[model samples]
Target chain A: MSRAALLVLADGRFPAGGHAHSGGAEPAVAEGRIRDADSLAAFCRGRLHTAGFTAAALVAAAPHGLDPLALDEAADARTPSPALRATARKLGRQMMRAARATWPGPDLDALARARPRGAHQPVVLGLTARSAGLGPEDAAHCVAYETVSGPATAVVRLLSLDPFHATAVLARLAPELDRVAEQAAEAARQQIDALPAASAPLLDITAEAHAAWPVRLFAS
Target chain B: MSVHARARLRAEPDGRGSTALPVLESAGPLALRRTRSPRPPYARVTVVGAMSAPLNGDRLAIEAEVAAGARLTVDAAAATVALPGPRPDADPSTYTVNLTVGEGAALHWLPEQLVSAHGSRLHQTTRVQLAATARLLLREEQILGRHGEPTGALTTRLTVHRAGRPLLDQQLTYGPDAPAGWDGPAVLAGHRAVGQLLLADPSFEDAPLPARLLGPTAALTPLAGPAVLVTAVAADARLLRGILDDAMRELLDGLKA
Candidate 1:
């Protein structure tokens, strides 16, 4: 497997349509809960351990020859908020398009045909990783990193905080991020039912609220 | 003392447009009492705890089934408080609940809040299965602590399946042993009470509710299926219940129409 492919896949500008969503950072900012780097770090940490861990597990399981459709169902099960589900599929479709262009394969083609509308982003990420000769751990790391990086980036734009400070927050989270990804990869080896179901109810609640915002910087 | 208990209840439709309970069994601390229903065609049953339950190492199970065309409502007399077991080091208690609704049946499972007191450890799982035409209204509330005290470790999982397809599955953890930052800005945000109301009705398939926020800390969203889920968090159980009760009224009114 080309290690460089991991960098390309994990790039923030991967054309995955993630830029449209704030990963719940927008709602927290509006509520005045995230005013600076410290609060943002706390928010990202809570997110990483809960929903982030769950997403990482899904991505990790996706590349191990697991059925994409079953993984899609599992993703839906883990996602209780309709708005988040819509956001995931939107990002998934965009990722699928980019992956098909970068590394086309029969597996990617079949899944794209099956979920013409879109699959969950993590499910597609796993498949995209597979098509690109990446493994489950690679997929897990990509998603785990994105889970916090997306929010950090959005908070920078929303709060007008220093980009360096945001980057520092992420750097500080590297250890926990690694831990979550490692655990997620291990959980992925178990039965689909045994996959982590950790949830952040506030994220689900705020995503629903964010979806209704007539004018917002982010889609979710 | 560690104990294993089970409660089984079944509601069937009578020929005269009413519901009848043909099976009702209670064992150990699970006391199932039949009660009067404010509305006709719906049987009401209240669960009363005969003893302190869900202590460490306790295994408790409650199973309820609503047959075709039947309507049943199950409620609890008081909140179920989780207390530490007698031994300082004891295994966490487990409570399992399974509910099923048949074709055209309706089940309203509205119980009191579950309080996880200090020094307690509990794991609870609730699963619901619904037929294509069934209607279900389920409410769940959790209070982290009694009052001004640190919460005990509590984990709860709720899974719902409609017509052989997953509708919702989520696991929530709280208290000392929970992951760090659980009470941070993006999660509970220092709220001691958390709850959700799930309403699954075929009528919603035609006119789904537009997703919106109920108040500052709550939101109502349409699910993938013909259902709506309302989630809220408040400073106390009373306030949490009030928020959910309001949402319940709104959703039930929408369902009736």
Candidate 2:
């Protein structure tokens, strides 16, 4: 099942340009909504239920041997924010680069060629998981976990939380991860052939506002 | 003043009851009071106004106003579910809401959720006018029916304009007679609750707190010019409400800062 490969893909330090992005932490920190560890934890939890749920559900539901381009388009539609779309594409590109180097496959190559403009991270992650022989449920877990962990880790770096404390925060999030992953898995099972839809207007507005800031730490 | 279907109920005198009270009352038309806050740079203000009318098959027209530099957010306590008339060949139930926001003012047009029951047909129209510098955070959510309950057909038309130019013009039609079309990717995607929040001429680049607090589910999208759109969609009403509350707090905080 290439557990090592999956870990590498999910690692925060995979050099997929995640380090430069706070997944909205930089802006939120500047705004003072997330000032400490407790606030950060609460914020991450909210994200997991909303955006994280949407992305993981889609990745988990992608049909076996599904076309990556179609998956990418669906992910793009689900993401209404242009700034977020750009960030997802950037992260996707870097992840694809890493995947091509670690586990080269014809399907991956086909998916890469199919996305001439850009690819979304969830789409690439799903393809990479399938290429590594991981099941849909596992793929969904990895996607959901990474989605939350990426921002949590970014908060640690941004807020200067002790590394140990950050780990603890991630540990506390384990139950939520399991719950959301189970929901994603069930959604995938129920609608394996269907596409994904997320129409969140407020999030898109914030993303748009964040992008125009002259100075910002996160890519999104 | 035009007369439509009208019915009034006065308090009945009870022999055993000590206090005299009016059980129910029906007015000539839906009584609507519009007030604007006397202040400058008012980001958003919300006012909820509703009246109970008899089930006397009348179409009510409501004119709501939000004065300049004053914001208003309106919503009913519950869905104004319309029922079929006594006669088989009766006119459908309809309600029209006219909204106006003055210059340099912001209005958040968020209404309570809507629920349509079986054999019910409703038509609603919302018209919004925004000033050049004024902003609007408007949203509407609708649920077809209660779980395991029958749902009737419903149609909604929305028109939004800024400086007399159309910003949004769309129509949504759904009902029992209509084909089950929510399962597709372009539609609800099997989601029971659907909501849309629109922010006009907002400072998109200035949302750091909400971006950080909301994390992944909440994102900001840059539109042409100075407008931005923030969105978050969830499976249930609770999650949706939470997201909306967080987003509003962040936005209000941003304005204060």
Best by DockQ: 1
- Please state the error at residue B139 of candidate 1 in Å: 0.3
Tens digit of lDDT per residue, candidate 2, span A1-220?
7677668767777766767766666656665656777766766665665567667876776535565665665565456466787888888888789778877888778878887555888787777777777767777788778766766777777788777877787799888888877777677655322332323233344555678789876677
* All candidates: DockQ: 0.74, 0.06
lDDT of 2 at B191: 45
Q: How many Å off is the CA of A158 in candidate 2? A: 2.1
DockQ of 1: 0.74
Candidate 2 off by > 4 Å? A190-203, B1-257
Q: What digit string (tens of lDDT, one per residue) describes model 1 on residues A1-220?
A: 8899999999998888887788999999999989999999999999998999999999999887788898899888888788899999999999999999999999889999999999999999999998899988888999989999999999999999999999999999999988999999999999776788888889999998888889999888
- Residue-level lDDT of model 1, residues B159-244, one tens digit each, is 89899888888888988888777899878988999998999998888888888888888988788778888889999999999999
The models' CA-based lDDT, in order, is: 0.91, 0.58
Model 1 chain B lDDT-worst window of ten = B248-257
